[model samples]
Target: METGKSYFFVGIGGSGMMPLAMILAGRGAMVAGSDRSLDAGRVPAKFEALEKRGIRLFPQDGSGISDAQQVVVASAAVEDSVPDMVRACEVGATRMSRPELLSRLFNDSVRRIGVAGTSGKSTVTGMIGWIFDRAGRDPTVMNGAVMTNFADSQAPFASALVGEGDAFISEVDESDGSIALYNPTIAVLNNVSHDHKSMEELRTLFGDFVGRADAAVINTGDPESAAIAAGLDREMVLTFAVDRDANLTARNLKPEPFAISFDLYIAGDFRQTVRLSVPGRHNVENALAALGAALASSIPPPRAVPALESFTGLRRRFERVGEANGVAVIDDFGHNPEKIAATINTLHEFPGRLLLLFQPHGYGPLKVMRRELVAIFAQKLKRGDMLVLPDPVYQGGTVTRDVTSADIVADLAPAGIDARHIPDRDAAAAHLVASAKPGDRIVVMGARDDTLSLLAKRMLDDLNR
Candidate 1:
């Protein structure tokens, strides 16, 4: 992240790429990029916001990579056949992967906090960032999702906050094995589950991730995370849990529709009652993880716990779009089994039938977790609940389609779950809206796609009609 260095991101509008581009631009680096979404005329607001920041946007053609000194940054998903990459090679521009550059900047920071896991990474990172900001630490924070606490009219996408403090907080990804690149002073491991990689591989990656950190904050309730904690020195680990005894624990959880209240305990001593604006026991676990990171960073409980009270959460994690005609629509980033289960469990706490539209994030993920996805939907959806599936999101990548959304729907049928495979997302939304009752909750769940939020809003709008 050298000052005044020119960087061009191939997939500039992506969740991971957008924040890094903003951070680079904020730090005096000349930033510009291009996206296929921009070419397709999708999500114009996101491209408009980027252009407003003086980051030039171009079509996905080779026109964006003219300068030889301009460094081209791309995610692992970007194929070498992309015109930008080909043009970069033609122009002899330096090429760097997104994680490579991000890790470089993360490793350079004096005090780095890396939040990792299969689930709750974004929420926990947002919580830690909000706490540090409220404490006046002026920390620079990077996250995959927009932090609603920092989002406003000027900066609608506040995924990255650039500050002058010594702390640099970011969520490190293990799905791509890039978690090894980060070296954190304080590391937070929420939980491990089957998402992108095998449990054995995830364990090895997570174990080494915390191994590099000076202090690790782990969730004892998760068996995989607890196993990792078992091998670490007790003095170097700060453990948190809701169902198990740990260094930090939450007791007497009171779940609400959109918020939750719980008693915070530290080492068996009662501390204070914590009321989080975000709902779900998963969030209660997330809160404990963030507080553990803050504690490991030497921030007092009085200062850190109170900031979570004001934390409004991320944009797509169970974000309520609107309520119309007694039916509520929620937009969620619940692509994996664990995240989907958490969302279902939290919503089921109240008395409402759930009409779910779960678009698989990718064809590859469907192939990887076909059985797990089917099992989660069958186990979580009650007899009266309805489920709809759109085709997995495909953005011009070559992938095997052996396991499609139809397979998932077929699998759910044996369990007496009412599920349908509506290949078109618009038709899926229509089904969700048409089937939604007065006391039902219409939930749009998926990841890797920004249009899901817009779909949720449209469902609410149709319900209003």
Candidate 2:
């Protein structure tokens, strides 16, 4: 319940838990954690970084919890049956959910901003943080991906940075309903779409997230977010959009193959011409949401717009891995139905046959959005489009094996999509590299695995050779 305590995390290798553990370790707390993945040899580089931070790693076998004084923290993904969780409870240790622990520390900051959205959350989080950093305003920023702007020798773009300044910025989650814990000075909602929760649940969670903030910045173009904007008190809401009348809107949206550019407008008056190093109209929309957050923090448009242009984008979210011998390989973190459609739809504006390599994140999620996923690929992919799918990325969690990429392939095949399941990363890469032509965009798509980008780059190298 207090500071200066030794803490043990059940899933330390998780994106959310690792950053929080690192912050706790940096704050001089004795922090150690364990993960089933660490034993499985996934994300070994991340574990090495944590070890360098003086945080020891352990197996998720409950052996790490040696004393009652050591608090145990874990994510909702960690089951009660997990050995670490069982062991922590056996020792009468205090346990906290990842969000619960983050809230306690995050709420203590003078300026806490939570960016909530189904997609574009990571990119918007990174954009806001970069604005603050470029302005010389040291702010603690927590993001899901490595922000290119924050990539440097000392931090190595650690997903989160604990700055010496008063501001605390984090990407909140409404899909898991963990966003309820956040009490923020400014809250930004990018857009609402399905992944883990129902639309009804998401609407309430996102609406309530905005209500908890002193001021809410929302995307007016999105119907779900616009509904939240309408219900908010005039003084409490700030809206951004590309079409509708909003406090901030991007007009003249021009999207190219590799990047998107638009003009920013406020209340029908022209503000500035904004350019993004990232592609798609979705990214342009993301930039507007980020601009609103910076404006809410009293950072001028001049500073925010330049920072947005300077943004090289996050680790995923349409990240270009390599362009070997004119074959461009992209790595994107788009697993859900809507997000997948958006990425595919946007690539239509570019110059290439959309050669998509989709690895489902898990069997359960792929099953949950099975029909929608099938329809998206069937609708978006063209005649010559190619799809390479690996089996669902699952290590331990129980899932119905019947529900898989094969199911999606079966559905897509009926619609004439050249889709097949390869079931392994290496074969998928080899097949893609061998088949890719000069104008094919070889995109590796999925989430939860940090090494997908590396695999995408390797595929590009193989194609070049």
lDDT of all predictions, in order shown? 0.94, 0.85
lDDT of 2 by residue, 120-168 (tens): 8888889889889988888888888888777666666478887888889
What range of 10 consecutive residues in model 1 has the weakest lDDT sum? 1-10
The alpha-carbon deviation from the true structure for residue 389 of candidate 2, after best TM-score superposition, in angstroms, is 1.8
When summed lDDT is taken over every stretch of 10 residues in candidate 2, the lowest stretch is 149-158
Model 1, residue 366: C-alpha shift (Å): 0.7
RMSD of each: 0.8, 1.8
- What is the Å distance of residue 108 in model 2 from its true position? 2.4
Which pairs of residues collide in model 2?
none
Local accuracy of candidate 1 as per-residue lDDT tens digits, 1-465: 468899999999999999999999889898989998899988899989888888998888989888899999997778999999999999999999999999999999999999999999999999999999999999999999999999999999899999999999999999999999999999999999998999999999999999999999999999999999999988899999995799999999999999999998898999899899999999999999999999998899999988989899999999998899999999999999999999999999999999999999999999999989988998999979999999999999788899999999988888999999999999989988988889899999999999888888888999999
